[model samples]
Target: MENEVLQDVMLTATILIPILAALVEVLKKAVKLPKNLLPLISVVLGLILGVVSYKFTDLDLVLRLWAGAFAGLAGTGLFEALKTRIGTTK
Candidate 1:
């Protein structure tokens, strides 16, 4: 079961990573935000995108995959948010 979970996690992560990266790039170009801010924005966008996906899926393996993907994406975003806050602490 652990292997299944991890496999799901990795599968989800792999798929979302590319989509997130591409979306981030498009947003960067579209909004003209600072290049340095891409990571932060990507993190936020990724979570929001994930949430939206989570709310709108109801298949079998596809649903599971989407759930896992969004979980990973949001977790990654949360990690980045924490990392940013930690790095900026005075």
Candidate 2:
């Protein structure tokens, strides 16, 4: 049904946003962002994504929080994984 399709889209967005954010953060090293701020940025972006997902899907608050947390963690994990793979540790 239409509702199921919308839910799928929202879920996909919820997952991809953080991954994409991580990718951008990793690749945009020339931007010179402070290292300490990256996690905070990811968390805030994840929270915003969760709010948008909730607005679109009407999902419960707990689920939204989980989505946000997962997204934040995913961003950090992805960044670390990429960094390891690229051998760019500080």
Candidate 3:
């Protein structure tokens, strides 16, 4: 039960970290990031989030990679949604 809960938390972190990173990137204009680099940034952040969240776990390598990819996709989707809703005209 405890292990399941821990895994859930790790998975949530795996998804949320990249999304949060994307949000920060979009909201902050001090750093001039090229728009084309957003996906790369999302993937990298997802990879880092996956590794940090699951490093101590005994999960398979493929599973970890899949989680990271999912995180990247989630971040991209969230970023686009927020951008459309918030109107990034600034």
Candidate 4:
């Protein structure tokens, strides 16, 4: 359980940093992107993160990678749905 949590932490960090960085760059450069793209972006970012983390960290590569992908999709779906249902747009 602890090990899974640790791996998840590493996975989240790996995925979030680059996504946030890219978002920053997009905003800074005024890059135009399609709407409703955030979810797909998250997935791709998750994949990249999974690969890198598995390469550099002491985690089960296949399991961690799958976990990252699952977490990314489920997380985005859950949060987005919650936000919409709660009528919070911020």
Candidate 5:
């Protein structure tokens, strides 16, 4: 049961991370906000997505929120990692 829950959250977060990253990228391009705020925005967006996705998963609000938070943070890290790898840091 524990493993199943973990798998569910991980799967959900994995799906959400890339989407959050893309959304952040779009916001970055459209807005002139500071780079530091991107992560926070991603988190907020994640939380919103998480809550909105309640119908898609059996997980409760708390678990969904956790998945969202993980997705948000991992999404930011993924973008940074790729950026560093590509030498595109500004």
Candidate 6:
């Protein structure tokens, strides 16, 4: 049961990463934030999304928060990697 729960958190994080990344992109375009602040924004956004999504999953608040943190970091990394690969950096 413990392992399954962890797996669920991992899955939730994985799913949220892309969505968070896209949201960051939208913010990037709509707002004039410094690039250095994007990751921080992503994390906060992820936490908000996770907490608000309680109705969608049975995970406890702590687990959901952990998943959100992971998703936020991963989302930043994924976005950076894709941006670099596509020659869109800076």
The lDDT for every candidate, in the order shown, is: 0.57, 0.65, 0.64, 0.58, 0.90, 0.90
Name the runs in model 1 displaced over 4 angstroms.
55-90
Taking the tens digit of each residue's C-alpha lDDT, what string does model 6 give over 1-90?
Answer: 999999999998998999999999999999999999999999999998788768878999988998898999999999888764465445
lDDT by residue (tens digit), candidate 4, 1-90: 988777665666555554544543364357565647766765665556666666656667765666556555654565555444355445
Worst-scoring 10-residue span by lDDT in model 1: 54-63
**Candidate 2 structure quality by residue, lDDT tens digits, 58-87:** 666655655665677677767766555355
Worst 10 residues of 5 by lDDT: 81-90
Candidate 5 local lDDT, 1-90, one digit each (tens): 999999999998998999999999998999899988888999999988888888889998988999999999999999988774465445
Better of 2 and 4 by lDDT: 2
Structural similarity to truth (TM-score) of each candidate = 0.53, 0.58, 0.58, 0.46, 0.88, 0.89
Error of 2 at 23 (Å): 7.5
**Model 4 weakest 10-residue run by lDDT:** 19-28
Which residue pairs clash within candidate 1?
A: none
**Which ten residues in a row are the worst by lDDT in model 6?**
81-90
RMSD of candidate 1 to the true fold?
7.4
Stretches of candidate 5 exceeding 4 Å from the true structure: 84-90
Clash counts for the predictions, in order: 0, 0, 0, 0, 0, 0
Error of 3 at 83 (Å): 2.2
Model 6 quality (TM-score) = 0.89
**Model 6: runs farther than 4 Å from truth?**
85-90
Off by over 4 Å in 3: 1-14, 17-30, 55-58, 85-90
Off by over 4 Å in 4: 1-30, 74-90
Q: What lDDT score goes with residue 18 in model 1?
A: 60
